[model samples]
Target: MLIGGILRDSSFFCIKMSAYPFFYPMAFPQWKEKLLYWADSRFSYFALTQGNEHSYPQNPFDSCFFAGNKELSENDLWQKRAFKVGVLGYDFKNQIEKLESNNPEFFSLPDLCFFVPELIFKIDSEGIYASSRLSAEFLSEIETQVIPETGSVTCKISPQITRESYLKSVQNIQNEISEGNTYEANFCQAYSGEFETWSPIAAFLRLNQLSRMPFAALFKAKNNWLVSASPERFLKKSGSSLIAQPIKGTIRRGETASQDSENRKKLLASEKERAENLMITDLMRNDLARVSKTGTVRVEELFGIYPFPRVLQMISTVCSELNPDTSLKEIIRATFPMGSMTGAPKISTMKIIEREESFKRGWFSGAFGWIDESGDFDFSVIIRSIIADSEAKKLYFGVGSAITIDASAAQEYEECELKAQAILELLRGN
Candidate 1:
């Protein structure tokens, strides 16, 4: 009754909450599934997840919010409005003057808008705490509502680019590096499939179990869904301090523990991986400098090796003190497509990427997360993700690696396959 009544209140700002937090005795999966079911029934909705059980500073909560009870995809998404929670698409690059996207707009999840959650939950070691500004009556109603169970999803996959074609594209990128057209380029391949059991919520839960990263997100707009398990943080703002962690180098994990340690060491010691990391780091610094106070941009971590389930990666942390005049538009204008997804000398490399890759990235390489009323936000790079269209029974996953001069065509192709293994395995209904 509270949701039924409060949702009609367009001027609704916040909900009334209890004097203390209520501890709900429920597992995270059940909690998440309930929220997913609630969101699926809403018009515009989004859920930003860390995917891990423990809470970290950057990812403190797994929050879900919905805007209208009806779906809308307006191009005015960039019109200088404050959006507390929403999803930005990869094709948004075309709106900027420097980048262009010729890829077909086959997916409907291009851009979405959602209102701040009338219901909010924070899960930590203590317990699940519910927070809301709505009436106590409404809170009680939500507490009593029962969440239904999710059924299984089935899928059959097909590659958009064959092994030979991906190899050829890698060769072409290497040739570009040789010609001095660009220092590095991120080359991607697409894999698509037909699904009988295609529940976005279920797929996301499985991906979360397989790869528990710091920056995971679930975005559902009508029939289109973006379920991601990404480890890369594109941007985060706390006061005037802005932070970004760009991942550059990747190598598959070993079958044995000893071998895995050796892989991490190898990635750390490799001059090639470090060079790639540094190149992207420098690019990020330059982009940040454009909106940052002079001489404020600095690298907090350099060539730090972080291990995932399938691979170990080289990531660098770059930070900057923001200039008071910098707007969200300026921040995005300077760094629309992140450097990790695009190689060094971003402009030139993006042009080469468009020419090389066969399919458009859609929302794969873009950023999405939450931005509050105070102008603070956190967004994650859209990698290690799957986009599904339940209506068409189609699902797509895109994988790519940063191609440097020292890169081998065969190894790069294999790297793409390694990166996609988790989601591919899930699609196989494992």
Candidate 2:
């Protein structure tokens, strides 16, 4: 840490860049204007700020920007997207002179872990970011130009999500599985028209319009790197220990306060829900143990019931102090495609999902965050996000809950509806 140039007195606001540094308060009115104006000229830039809080400076930094991560070709898998993670900011300022003494890859890194809470940091300009205050009222200036011409086709919700269709789909998945097919294929449907849009910010408001969970974020790690409002943490690293909190079960919030309390009570006692939550929790524990000390991996919390605007969820935290020699990338390689996103036997589920799903997930399920020079990192699962290829001008996000025999399609669909709230509202006029 640079004691001299630190964004003094600001615990959570600090940039990793020494050249074109960025550090700001929780809410800044004119920050975005300055960024848009200087982005082209700066030796470096940052996308900082958090807007998912539903509070001041409405526009928070949630964009992923870096020439390092962009696709230069139409045929490139990541072309037009900046979801490939990288280390950014001035965390490496002092390390610059010592590059000749260490492995370059270690010096320059992928954003595989998230540590260091609150302090603003940036690296070589690769990682997820968002502009402060811009999102607060971004729609006012956003006029839909014709959806840019695209090789990818526009999608529409043929059967708008309703209790009926959602339940049927669940039955369909179960029937297919009973036939010995697969477990969890992330089946997602569209909810928009060619001209109509679902603004991400608006959807965030509508769904999370109520949430009791902490650490929600609307992150733009880059364009393909976006999370509308993710309320859970996939993994974290601190000292020798690694932590992961996977949210498994969910039930819509009740219509009345008393009803809501009852709903929470039932969710706590649901055997199937608890089982599903534990499976993922165990999976996460195993993932962390890969880089963690033997016998050190343990579940910190189990089936911890949490409240969200739309539903009640069961989240469990699994932690293990990392092995001394472990690398951040190895930890991610083993744990990513988080169990919450992919079902048990992750590798098999991923294969099933890739074969069945029509679109490439891009950064959707991938991790996004900043890893400074020290390998200290922070990453959120890519759920509740909008993926866009600016050159082509298309966007995508999906909502799904885990499927179990006892799962109800109606409630799951409602859960999905709650998930899409933000994006749906943003497209209001479009």
Candidate 3:
């Protein structure tokens, strides 16, 4: 079954297979030597629906993985149908070199990495589909491999910054807001630990099961792995339409249904939360306006509350019709290290982030997703993720919230804890 299209004999071939429950986990071992990437849209109702119809807007594949052949340079990324998988690190921002602090050498992921894959597998409501430069014989081999059972994983981790230090940083950011240095800033902290026994695939599956987020992904580049259960979309491009969904406000789920309803109401009614979301929404609108057609930028959805297993989030969607002449590089440069990850008056707020954040964000506040043959792409903000370096036996993740003048240092600390709870549970083998 030919998918996408027929290429030359030396190019990729396509096939269709019956969907198997264990396809994702087993594919890892079979393609151990290749750069593997998997993105799953587990909760589609929130991201894929508009009005009464369920349609994938910027993403064509609801769930898919790519086995890459070689890394591609940034200049080569926008070639027609490049079909690349990669990530952009938070340090991609300008004047990153001015920051005095950095993540330790073990967490030194590159600022940018994208690969041209030789094999692709897409799973949808129908079944599994494959496109590859490999032979049909190899494709059959993948189908017959035994599915490995999920294994246990355990680790001990500690926050890089003490609670007092975190609170102090928040206070400093609030001071900056008050002094007119910036309206808001995102201050982040890290947790680091050594793994006792590691099973990357198992840990990823467990995390995916626990979060069941819309933009779940597993990315491997050599010994480094990024297992993400992110619920926020950084950006997307489909035809002339460009969209970005920024998540600003978060509240933990309640123990009971009535309590959960009350909490949602409280989040909706919050003056501080609304202020936070509004500031970033305006930031995004201004950014998108740079590359957008004249007078085309607008906010599509404002303060839309969405639920996950552990928390409910306030997400606002901003969209614009792009200028036909705009290039991929221009689009990214205009709206990256997303506004929610930074803050209002982006440049000054980012400087505050660099000075106040405990460590370099690496890929934490960056993005990961695919660019398809049509030149359309979709990327998720790299939050709620674990960055593991097997060679160093080290694993770490970063979490933060936007701090405005009215922010409470103690309450912001609690918000970070709520964000880290899933990864903490996974590390403890809970």
Candidate whose TM-score is highest: 1
Q: Can you give the lDDT of residue 323 in candidate 3? A: 92
lDDT (10s digit) by residue, model 2, range 74-167: 1221121212232222112112222111211111222222222222333212222322212322222222112222222233422234556566
User: Over 4 Å off in model 3, which ranges?
Assistant: 1-61, 95-106, 124-127, 131-140, 143-152
> Model 3: per-residue lDDT, tens digit, 255-353?
999999999999999999989999999999998999999999988889988777899889888999999878788888889879999898888888888
lDDT of each: 0.72, 0.49, 0.73
TM-score to native of every candidate shown: 0.87, 0.63, 0.84
Candidate 1 ranges beyond 4 A from true positions: 4-22, 27-29, 51-83, 111-116, 125-127, 133-150
Residue 64, candidate 3: alpha-carbon lDDT: 64
Worst ten in a row by lDDT for model 3: 43-52
Q: After superposing candidate 2, which stretches have Cα over 4 Å from the reference?
A: 1-45, 49-172, 175-187, 190-227
Model 1: lDDT equals 0.72
